[model samples]
Target chain A: MSDIVTAAMLVIGDEILSGRTKDRNIGHLAEMMTAIGIDLKEVRIVADDEDAIVEALNAIRARYTYVFTTGGIGPTHDDITADAVAKAFGLPCEHDERAYAMLAENYAERGMDFTEARKRMARMPRGAVHIDNPVSIAPGFRIENVHVMAGVPSIFQAMLDNVVPGLKTGTRLISVSIHCPAGEGTIGGPLGEIQKQHPDTIIGSYPKYLDGKFWTELVVRARTPEALAPAEEAVRQMVARLTDSAAAI
Target chain B: MSDIVTAAMLVIGDEILSGRTKDRNIGHLAEMMTAIGIDLKEVRIVADDEDAIVEALNAIRARYTYVFTTGGIGPTHDDITADAVAKAFGLPCEHDERAYAMLAENYAERGMDFTEARKRMARMPRGAVHIDNPVSIAPGFRIENVHVMAGVPSIFQAMLDNVVPGLKTGTRLISVSIHCPAGEGTIGGPLGEIQKQHPDTIIGSYPKYLDGKFWTELVVRARTPEALAPAEEAVRQMVARLTDSAAAI
Candidate 1:
């Protein structure tokens, strides 16, 4: 936990809050962050209002090593993310000329009119770095440690792929999951004891009620394989004991 | 906005943050809250750590009219929501006889022993109101305005159904979506002007790239039909103009 590189996400969209659109970025980001060394500590989903965006940005940016915000960076009236980011950082927002050219070229190639609303996508806070948009020409921006991204899942994933490989992350946490046919109540005490014994490993118990049978899973996570091995063995042995007794019953 | 009943959600689970499980509660709760006239303003997903849970609870409870927390209330080691809620409220967490009796009866009917881990589900904050769980025997609790429910989708939905009908709510916000075959850039300017004109209605522009074609949607929302009707008409006219222009091209 001491050396774990922590990150947080801010998901901004009215559609998500209204249940009109289910979020896809959170799950994809979580999986990718876990595969790398970053510990995704928290996620906050807020509406498109500027105050809500600023408050969430300030809170998440201050707490974690990195903050990735998705949504409201589009060519529309409600796309207030860039303006909110500028307000949060006390900086002026302006159109980045380079991003403008890139977007203009993209539109030209597609035989579409590059209107003023499309130009709005180029705006970002002062001292911001452009994050590439592989799927679209409208680039996401990075101010300090906060990475702004598109709300659309494909564009968000592309921006994340462009950003994550370059970040400073810690040791990738190794995870091992044990699928146990035993119930949580039958195995909870021993699992807790095992978790306490291995303080470095994070042990989680997940219960599933499937086919009218209650089964539980024990997952162990550690910074290194060496740390994960012992805790995993403990869980396997405990599950074996419980499974044998339950079979006898 | 004056009478809007605002709500926030805290999803407490390591499994969601770790990407082992994709959260299904937020969308379900959001849709249900919208149906009953509550604006789900903010959502926070935190790990099973007590400090994180307590911090999210304190912040959201002070700001929102209601807080609904899902997960971390099971019969497992990581099921620490009850204790965390108790710590946040400065209350004693004790076994409720009513909950214990209900769970005991349910387990007896299934011919299973009510073990210690099972009993942990009965522990709730002092002076908490028990929210019935139709799927499982363990009851969720409501302390003040923060409703603590199970992470499982079915149980969470059942608890929400039992709890939401009793709460005082405002006028349900009505929404209308206009699917425009045109792009966001074509409609952004006029939409912003219309939004400025009709300050009561919230218009959101969502762009989509579907089936290799570019399309956008304008969603209009207002608390009353009287407020929404004119704004919806304006969007329809705007989209009609955009479609004509694109056709001419």
Candidate 2:
């Protein structure tokens, strides 16, 4: 397996930016990427404008191993993700026959006419492969490294379930958390030194305020359990020593 | 008032990227920005790495009217946002006397030692103005167009309340929402025409799946009520016409 497989998420929507909608997709994708050993390196949320979508899509897709985008895929004027992605890749976007057939059949089965607007869902960048959406028949597409999906959380998740199995994964990261009764103020100095000593591990100190008192949680992550254990132990010892000294004082 | 005021949010943290923390600040800030007539144009969530922070901060602050960053202001080795913002502005990052006085007094009042680690919370870019935090004594700072705030949701909100008064606002946006019993596929064609007819207003169609049926909510927004009213009425008439025709068939 690769040592690190990285991904970035692009949320394309006006509702989210306008505060009319709260995004549930970013957290879902972030957690999904983490569990599958892909580091979600960055996330960019842009509006539904084609120019903004093309610009952001081009920027992040060039840097990350994979880019997942949500929103702007429905059959509406604002649903311009397909065209924007095609522009980003410099490919001609047209109605894919397979996608057309799928959506056509779905609407037909429901005794509905697959209008020109419904057929718009079938459009994709040339040479793109359809990502199956069991929730709704309108398929998302994969053009190069970018996986474009719907913005709705349920459909996005359903599409992701179909996409995850095919991705190149990295070595699973091992994480250990140590709770500190003391605040980062009391332990941050020594914790920095421990981080320096354990160069292979990532040590993160998160502060939490509860019941009018502040405390810190230290999480150490490494590629292997062997690499994680020592850093975890060092953090535990540092918290114990500092909290003990603070209590004594 | 300005016709448009745009802002971007940069979230600095590994915890958010790693899926250990779900971001509440983005939604909170987005809603707040919209309410205050500022367009939240884009949002970028980056890691705690200084280079990443500096790059993203520079990219966004140069484009938007203002840039707000959340996270990495705490007293820890991983808290690198202040230094990163300073680097982006090519300024010296050192202990701000006012922030130092505020945090030191808070620690003293709480019967805690203001250690070197605690003092680290007082650091800010040179010539930055401190944004007051009522939830915590450690202040967030604003240098140039960038406002660096805390990761904790409560502290971030409190600091935002203090920062908003100083910002330049635009004309307040007027929004009208109309629900459609039909899906976007059924109403999308005429809706697109309505959007083209009202170029001054932004028409957004949001699809929702409830009770095994897909419906849409159309929201029209414009800077003035006059611009918004006509677009909203057009959308309402379009949805009514489409759903009625669909029902007749």
Candidate 3:
């Protein structure tokens, strides 16, 4: 409900920790959250161990406005995130009647047996609301501040889209970028001054050595578009002044 | 110097924290370390701030056997990883004569000016060794256990390939996957029993709901090829037994 919404991402699975899978979720979520004006504060990757999941869930959920977790919601023995979430929140995890019914209906339509293993998909923690998975009927759940979704990029992305509109958004985040061929030290001092002048705006510099010259890309971000304009102006002025100084030297 | 080789990754930039870039480096490093048996225990991502970089460097370098950092090593104003690494070790970060010589030669060969901004690429933390960047001349650094590499995938992958073989390796990690059309709970008991039998092996289950049927993918990992074979066999047997139970029910 605050003006600034802060969130943390918990990437679950040994694939991520073991490096077998290069996670595309973190970047996708970060970009989406920023566009919606929610600040992503931290990201932690943990193995699919229940204790680790529970511990991380408790810590992150308590610290941030919202916690988004991906992976381990599957019908496999290693899928323990749902149980962990229930344990972390001290809630009951049982097969939801509605979820089971939906699963049964979905499987029946495909002429598949609603086996016990499939029933695991119907389990939900008490007081949790399901997030529709259009790609797959095994719905993701939202318990308190924690939103548990699938690990697959396509499914995870689909689940996130469904969850975002329901979230309480803060001020819209806006940013501007400028590319300059200059070293950080040459612009570090003046950039600091610009930041001090525009305390509300956050300025970032990314330096790249391309084509044998150092080019620094400066990015300015703010909650309001108005706040971004002055910050951009100050950056331009400082970069020009730094370029001139280097020329004189 | 320790028998147990360890590694950590330092990610620099505010973009990662602000959720603009979902970091791909951590997963890549984790997988690579596992393959070589380096034992990646921890990872940290910090902002482009010098103090934050210094703090992370000191902490990780002291604890881990090897430290690998990606991002913020570029030639831009915000790219401060190089300076911060030098400061953390209490070393002078100055333009290395050899590095400058290399840069000048490389640039001249490419018909580009060795401008003052480009000179930033030559700065190295005192006593640091260079990690070759086949993609560009802005070499990454290696000091003690720390191996700095570029953030770009193509370049980072190349640098890693160059650096990995040099480090002392443990047993290689191998994995096997088996799919079962059953829920995790049906196999959880047997899965736990198998894990207990093979303490050295890590068994994981990932559940998927596709076409309205629950199917779980179980993966078993071990340090040695021989160990992986037995562990994977045990998982396959357990899954088969669970499948039988589901079919009967």
Steric clash pairs (candidate 2): none
Q: DockQ for each of the predicted structures, in order?
A: 0.67, 0.74, 0.31
Top candidate, metric DockQ: 2
For A1-249, candidate 3 gives per-residue lDDT tens digits of 369888888888877777766788888898888888887766667777788788767877997899999988876556778888899999889998888899999878966577665688888898789999987788999998899999977889999999999888879778888876664535655676787889888888765556545566788988777899999998988777766765422
Candidate lDDT (C-alpha), each: 0.90, 0.91, 0.78
Off by over 4 Å in 3: A86-116, A122-127, A178-200, A205-218, A233-249, B1-6, B17-24, B41-44, B50-64, B83-135, B178-199, B206-218, B234-249
**Predicted candidate 3 versus true structure: per-residue lDDT over B1-249, tens digit per residue:** 345576767777778876655566787789789878877765666667898789868977997778888877665556677898899989999998888898899868866567665677788898999888877767888988888887766678888888997898865667787887765545665676788889888887765556645566778887678788888888887767766764521
* Higher-ranked by lDDT: 1 or 2: 2
Docking class of 2: medium
Per-residue lDDT for A161-212 in model 1, tens only? Answer: 9998789888888889899887776777778889899998999998777766
Which has the better DockQ: candidate 2, or candidate 3? 2
Q: Evaluate model 1: give its lDDT.
A: 0.90
Clashing pairs in 3: A19-B31, A27-B22, A75-B207, A117-B183, A184-B77, A207-B75, A207-B76
Model 1 alpha-carbon drift over 4 Å, by segment: A247-249, B247-249
lDDT by residue (tens digit), candidate 1, B1-249? 577799999999988988889999999999988888899999999999999999999999999999999999988888999999999999999998999899899878877778888899999999999999977778999999999999988889999999988888978989999998887777777889999999999999888877656688789999889999999999999888877785412
- In model 1, how large is the Cα lDDT of residue B187? 75
lDDT of 3 at A137: 86
